[model samples]
Target chain A: MSYEDEINQDILNSKKLPEKLEISVLRYFWQSNPLIGKKTDSIPRFLRKIDVLSNFSENELRILAKYLHLRKFQPGEVIFKQGELGVGFYLLYNGYADIIVENTEGTDEVKPSSKHILTLEKSDYFGELALLQEISIRNASAVSRQGCELLGLFKPDLEELINHYPVIAAKLLQSISLIVANRLFSLTREVQELKYKLSSYEKDQDASN
Target chain B: MPQISINTKRERFKLIFFISTLLLAFIGLAAMPRVSIPLLLGYVIFLIVYPAVPTLEKLGINRVGSIWIVFSALIFFSIYPFVKVVPTVTAEIENVQYFLPKIEKYVTKKYEELRIEVREKTSFEIGDKYFFQALDWIRKTSTNILLNIPKILASLLEWIFFIPLIIFFLLKDGKKFKRGILKLTPNSIFERFYFLSHQFNKKLGDYIFAKFVEASIVGITITSGLLILNVRFALLFGLIAAITNIIPYVGPVIGFIPGLLFSLAEYGPGTTLGAVIMLFVVANAIDIAIVFPILVSKVVDLHPLTVVVSVILGSQWLGMVGMIISIPFAAALKLIAQEVYKEIYQE
Candidate 1:
C-alpha cells in the first residue's frame, strides 16, 4: 500500500495513530491552509455555556474571548474571601462553587462565621460588581466545591476592550448591568413579602390576645 | 494504572513534538536571515498597529483603509521629526564625542583626588576600580553598537522595503492563525493555552506601548525645557534622555551625565548645578508624576530588582535589543509561572 493508504489503514486499525504517522499527520493538518478571518470558533466549549456569554454572537464572543483568562481550582479552594477587594469576575465553566456569606453578628471567636448561602454550578458567574464599581469589597466568599475550571475577566482587560472594541464593550456592559438589576429587583420583592408577613403576624397576635 | 500510563505517554509525545517544532522553526529563521529578518520586522510592526485595526473596524472602516490610515499616520509623524532631528543630532553627537576626553579627564581627576583624601584622613580606602570598569563597559557597548550600525541600516532598509506587505498579510490572517492554533488544543488544557497567551499579549504589548509614550514625553519635555534655558545641544540632550529613559535605573544617570558635563565645561558650576537640579526634577518628576501614572501604571508587576537583573543579563547575552526586551520576557515568564503554579499547587 502507498504511504497515504497505509496511514489510513493504521488510523482505522486502532483509532490511534501510529507514532511516526501521528506527529507528521497532526503537523500536516495544523499547517494546512491557515487563513484570515478565523472567527470566534475557538471560544472554548466550556466558556460558551456560561450565561453571561450566552447572549453574545460568535463574532462578538471571539472579541471578548481575546481578553479572558482561564484558571483551575481544586475542591475546598477559596476563590475569594468576604470583605476582600474584588479585582475581577469569574465564569465557572465546570464543577461546583459555593457562594458563602459569613455571619458577622456574633463575637470574633466562638461563633460560626461562614455558611453556604448559594450553590453556583456551571455557567454561574460572580464578583461582577468589580466590573461596574470603583471599589468592590466582596460581600460573600466563593469556594470551589469540586475540581473546577473558570474563565476570568478582569477590570484592566475591560478597559482595553472598551478602547479597542467599543460597540462590543457597550453591549457587554449593558448585559452585565441588566443581570445585576434583575437580581436586585428579585431581592427587593422578597424583602417586601417578608415585611407583609411580619405585619400580618403581629395583627394576628393582637386579635388573639 | 493503564489509563494514567497512557496519558503520561501521550503527554510526553506531545511535549517532544511541540519542542522539536519550535526548535526547527527557530533554526530555520536563524539560518535564513534575509527572509526571516523582514518577517520578524513585519511581525513587530503588525503588533504595534494591531489594536487600532479592531477600533477602526468598530468605527466602520474596512481592513485596507484601516491599515493605510494607521501606517500613513505613523510614517508621517515618524519621518517628519526624524528628518528634522537627524541633522542636529548627528552634529551634536560629533561635538559630544569631541568633548568626551575632557569629561573623562575631569571625572577621573576628581575621583582620584577624593579617593586619596578619604584614604589619607579617614583610614578607609575608597575604590575607584569599579568606576573605571563601568566606564570601560559603556565604551565597549557604544563602540559595538556603532560598529553594527551599517549592517543594521542595511537590514532596516530591507525590512522597510518588505515590511508593509508582510504587515498587511498579518493583519488579514492573524486571527485565523490564532484560531487554528486554538482549535488544535486538546480540551484538557485548552483553557490554559488560551488564557496564558492572552495574558502574554496584553501585558507585553501594553508594556511596549507604555515605554514609547514615556520616551516621547521625556524627549519632548527635555527638548522644550533645554531650548527655554538656552542650553547648547538641547535637541541632542533631549534625544539622549529619551533613548536612555527606556533603560530603567541606570538610564536617568546615563542621560544626566553628558548634560552635566557639557554645562560644567562650557558655562561653569552655577549652570552645571542648575542642569543637575533640572535633570533630577524632570527625570524623577515627569517619570513618577506623569508617565507612570498615566501611560504605564501596573502594566508589568515586576519587582525593581527583577528589572535590574533582567537588564544586566540581557545586555550581557544579546546586547541592546536584548536589554530592551528582557523586562517584558521576564514579566511574561512570571505571569506563566504564577498561573501554572496556581494550577499545580492548588490541587
Candidate 2:
C-alpha cells in the first residue's frame, strides 16, 4: 500500500465501533467514580459560582483552589478583630458570617456597642484589601453568624502564586481590583447624591428664612 | 448565651489540643537526633535552594520537571565536591595533628621568653600555672578532635544518604505539608501564626543563604591565598576559617588564631607571619566591608549587641549549631516582639 493509503487504513481500523465504545465507557466510568474523582472536583465547582472569580478558567480555578485553606468556624466565633492586622482574604465557602463595626467614639470603652454592617453568604468574599495592602488592618470584624466554612487565601499563598503562576495571580489581582473599583464607583456616587441633597436642604432653609 | 459558651469551650479545647499536638511532635523530633539532625540539615538546604525551583517554574517548566532539574543539579554539584574534596580535607585534617604540636611548642617557648623578661624587669617570678593549663587544654582538645574525625565522617556518610532523600521529598511536597499544618491551626490564631511562621521562614532562609555566601567567599580567599603563599595545611586552616566565620564578632579572630600560631611557629615572627596576618585581615575586611553590608546585615537586621548576646546564649545551649542559628532566631524573636508591641501599644 501507498503511505497515504496505509495511514487511511490504520485510521479506519482504529475507528472501529468496539474501540470507540470502550474508550467512551472508560471515560464515563472515570468521571462517575465518586471515590476517586468527585471529591476534589467540588472546590473548583464551588469556585465556578463566584462572580469575581468568573474570569478564571476551569484549570486556573483548580490551580487556585490548591492554594486555598478551608477553615471551619464555630458559631459566634470571631474570624478577625477590628484594627487587627490581617493577611488573609477569605471566601465564605458555606454558611453565613456577620461583618460588625464597633463604635469607637463614646465613653463606653469597657462595653462598646457594635453595629451590624452586612451578613455575607456563601460565594461572598471579603478582605481583598488584606491581599493587596502592605499593612492591612481589619476595619470591621468578621464573626461567624451560625458556624461557617471559609476558603482563605493569604499573603504568603498569593506570593507563591505570583511566583509560580503569574498568569493566575494577575487574573486574581484583576478581579480584586475590579471589585474595589466597583465599590469605589458606587461610594462616590452616593457621596455626590448626599452632597446634592445637602445643598438643596440649605436652599430650602434659606428660602424659608 | 449557653450555646455561645459551649462553642467557646469547644474552641478552647481545640486550640489546646492543637498546641499540645505541635509540642508533642517537636518533642518527638528532638528525641531522635539521628533523624532530626539530617532532617534539619535537609530543611536548611531546602530553604536555600527552594527559591530556584519557583524561578525555574516561572521559566515555563512544570513543577515536577523543575524540581527534578534543581535536584539533579544540586546532587551533581554536591557529589562532585564530596568526591573530590573529601580525601584532600581528610589528609589535611590528619596532617593538622603534627602541625598542632609545633604551634603548642612555639606558644610555650614564647611564653617562657615573656616570663623571663618579666622576671628580669620586675625581679618577680611569673607564674606559668594558668598559661600551662591553657596550653594543655588546647593540646588535649586538638587531639580529641583529631581522633573524632572518623566518627564525624561516618555520620557525614549517613547524612549524605539521608539528606538528599529528605530534601527531594521536601522540595516535592513542602506546600502540601505546610497546608496540612495550617489545617491544624486554630481559627483564632491562624492568621497571626501563619504570618509569623512565614516571616520567620523567609528571614531564616535569607540569613542562611547570606551566611553561606559570606563563608564561601572568606574560605575561598584564605585557601587560595595560602596556597599561593605556599602555606602548609592551607585547606585545613581555610576550613577552620569558614566554619568559625559563622559566629558573630569573635569569629574572625578565632579563625585567624591557628593560622597566626602556625605561621609564627613554622616561619617565625617574620614575613610569612606578616603575610598570613595580612591575608586574614584583608579577608575579614572584605567580609565586613562588602559581604556583611550587602548580604547578611539586610537579612538579619539585628544590633551587634543582640547578635553577641544571642550567640553567647546559643553557644551555651546548643554549642556550634546554636551559635550559627542564633542571629536568625534573634531576628525572628524581634519580629514577634514588634508584632506584640504593635498589638499592645499601637491599637
What digit string (tens of lDDT, one per residue) describes model 1 on residues B87-134? 677667667666766766777777888989998899798777899997
- Fnat per candidate: 0.07, 0.55
TM-score for all models, in order of appearance: 0.59, 0.90
Chain A superposition TM-score, candidate 2:
0.79
Each candidate's number of clashing pairs is 0, 0
* Residue-level lDDT tens digits of model 2 in A83-202: 889999999999998898886664755566787888999999999899999999899888888889999999999988998899999999999999889989999999999999999999
lDDT of 1 by residue, A142-182 (tens): 77775677777767668768877787788789878878998
Worst 10 contiguous positions by lDDT, candidate 1 chain A: A36-45
Candidate 2, which segments miss by more than 4 Å at Cα? A1-37, A108-111, B1-6, B29-31
Task: Give lDDT tens digits, candidate 2, residues B1-347.
Answer: 11122357877898999999988997887677678778878999999999999899888899999999999999999988899888998988888788888888878888889989999999889888998888888888988988998999999999999999999999999988988898889888899989999989998999899999999999999999999999998988998999999999999999999888888999998899899999999999999999999998888777888989999998886678778877887898899899889878985
